[model samples]
Target chain A: DAGVTQSPTHLIKTRGQQVTLRCSPKSGHDTVSWYQQALGQGPQFIFQYYEEEERQRGNFPDRFSGHQFPNYSSELNVNALLLGDSALYLCASSLATGQGWFLGEQFFGPGTRLTVL
Target chain B: AQRVTQPEKLLSVFKGAPVELKCNYSYSGSPELFWYVQYSRQRLQLLLRHISRESIKGFTADLNKGETSFHLKKPFAQEEDSAMYYCALSPLGSGGSNYKLTFGKGTLLTVNP
Candidate 1:
């Protein structure tokens, strides 16, 4: 089975530039979430998209936003990027809501490593 | 707000030795805790969740609400066990909204052959 897939496995951009990372959820999954993982740190929650709407968000600023399409694909966009934005962007998909996650595990994509110089 | 904490930044153990990765959390409401592992060059994957009360790859975690800890433990540390581990927390009422999870700073496990 094809698991979660993310495009642009690695990206390099200058400060103040914008970057958009795409994610294809695992087959049979409908909810998508994005996270940021700094060097030597665990991934931090960014926001979650379900049914084409942002359902929940973390402590991130407005620069980070996301969209979920009808096909369950997701895109994470970061505007006015700064050097601190350089980190590994990970995408994870699960069934909508927290239901049955106790039964089926959350699938994760290989991640897009973004480097802002 | 919910948060996870992994006190150890790095943990080292010899082959055939036991391993324990500590995880703690703070939240006003009920919490769902999880342990996720990321092997070198691999994506982060769920190892186990407290609700399941199960073990994966010889690792197990028990939730102690009184202590607010969910420590991952393994009987024997294999060379393949070397990886980074993260503890996560999802708060109550996540079904409707607030589905986002909070993760800790992660612990890097190093197994010496």
Candidate 2:
């Protein structure tokens, strides 16, 4: 079975530009979440998508948005990116338990390295 | 606000030596803690969770509620154990498909043979 997959292993952009990263969830999984891992730091949650809607978001600004398709794939869009936005964009997929408590194990992709100059 | 803190940025150890990575969390309510690992050229994956109370690859972490910490430990380190280890925490009721995790800065473990 295929695990979570992300596209465009690496990308380069300039300040004020926009970028969209994609992710396909693991088989039998329905929820997808996006994270940003800056150099020398662990990942910070960007947002989570469930039932085609954003279910939870982190401390990120409005410039960061996401979409979850019916097939459980996801897209993370960052508009007007800044130099600080340059980081490794990670995609994690997990099975939603529906009860609002205790999510199962999360499987992460190889991550798309975004560099904003 | 929930937070996870891993004080060590890098840890080096000789093969067959014991290893311990420290992790501390700040959360008012009940929290779920986890340890995730990423080896060179491999995707990040879960190593273990506090709820499971099970060990993986000789690594085990105990949730010290009184101290608000979850430290990963192994009796004998192996060369292949070198990787980036991350500590993560999630609120009690906000997990699963709708989960939002707060992660530490992570510690890079280099086990030398």
Candidate 3:
């Protein structure tokens, strides 16, 4: 089975611009989560989606938003990107809810490397 | 607030040496613990979870609820084992909150010949 897949392997944006990153959940998976990973740092949760609705969100600001499609694919949108947004955006997928067997077994993608200029 | 802690940013040791990576977490509820590993140019993958009590690639992590710790250990380090390790805790849902995982800063391990 294909693991989580993310688009545009790399992205570049300017300050004040908006960016959208895409992710396709693994086959048979219905949950998707977004994370931001800075260099040399672990990933920070952004939000989680299930049943085509955002079921949970991290401590991120309103500038960061996401959408979950019926197919379990996801999109992460960041408005008014800042220079600090220059980091890797990771997309993970699992087969169940946050309390399921894969609670901590999030399957990650190669990640979309975002660089905010 | 739930938090995960990885004390070492970097660790280096010769091949065949025993390796240990320390992790601590802070959460009032019964949190689930996990260890994830990322090798060079590879996606982050789950190394193991606390509930399973199983070892992967010779690595094992035991969760100690009393001490709020889960340390990853391997009897012998292999050069291929070099990678970044992250400790994470999934805080149990309570009231109206959905569960979410908080990861530590991560520790990079280097296994040399």
Candidate 4:
């Protein structure tokens, strides 16, 4: 099923510039989430999208926004990139059920390594 | 605030030896714990979750609410088991916050032959 897929395995940008990362959810999955993993750190939740809307958000600033398309593909947009923003951006997909979104397993993609200078 | 902690940054063990990866969490409400693994050049994937109570790739984790810990254990470590393991926590509820995962720094396991 190709599980989850991400584009542009690696990216480089300068401070104050904006960057966008893309992700395609696994087949039949409707929920997508974004995470940031700094070197030597685990993935930190950024936000989650479901039904083409942002259903959940983390502690990230407003500069970090996202959009989910009807096809279940998502995009993470980070404006005013800072040096600290240089990290591995991960995109995860899962199914949303009546029980709870947390009940379903999240499948992750290979991740996009974003380097902000 | 919820947090997950994996004290060890790196762990080394000889093949066939028993191994345990420690994980501690801090959360006020009930949290669903999970173990995720990332092998070399591979994407992160779920290894197991506390609720399932099932072993995956010979690894099992037991959640102790009193101690607030979920440690992953394997009876006999294999070389293939070498990878980066992360312990994550998800709040159990119906709110939007419940969908996000809180993850530990992760433990890198290296099995020697």
Better of 1 and 4 by DockQ: 4
Please, what is the whole-model Cα lDDT of each candidate in the order they appear?
Answer: 0.88, 0.91, 0.87, 0.93
> What value of lDDT does candidate 1 attain over all alpha carbons?
0.88
Docking class of 3: medium
A77 in model 3: Cα distance from truth in Å?
0.4
| Colliding pairs, model 2 | A103-B96
Would you give me the overall lDDT of model 4?
0.93
1 against 2, candidate with superior lDDT? 2
lDDT leaderboard ranking: 4, 2, 1, 3
TM-score, candidate number 2? 0.96
DockQ of each: 0.50, 0.66, 0.49, 0.59
Question: In model 3, where do residues sit more than 4 Å from their true spots?
Answer: A97-104, B93-99
Clashing pairs in 1: none
Candidates ranked by DockQ, best first? Answer: 2, 4, 1, 3
From the highest TM-score down, the ranking of the candidates is 4, 2, 3, 1
Q: How well is candidate 1 docked (DockQ)?
A: 0.50
Q: Which window of ten consecutive residues has the lowest lDDT sum in model 2 chain A?
A: A96-105
What is the per-residue lDDT of model 2 for residues A1-117, given as tens digits with 9 covering 90 to 100? 778999889999999999999999999988899999999989999999888998889999999999999999999999999999999999999887756534677899999999999
> What are the clashing pairs of model 4?
none
In candidate 1, position B60 carries an lDDT of: 94
Task: Kindly report the docking quality category of candidate 1.
Answer: medium
Q: Give me the displacement of residue A13 in model 4, in angstroms.
A: 0.6
**Residue A43, candidate 1: alpha-carbon lDDT:** 87
Best candidate, DockQ-wise? 2
Q: Report the poorest 10 consecutive residues by lDDT, candidate 1 chain B.
A: B91-100
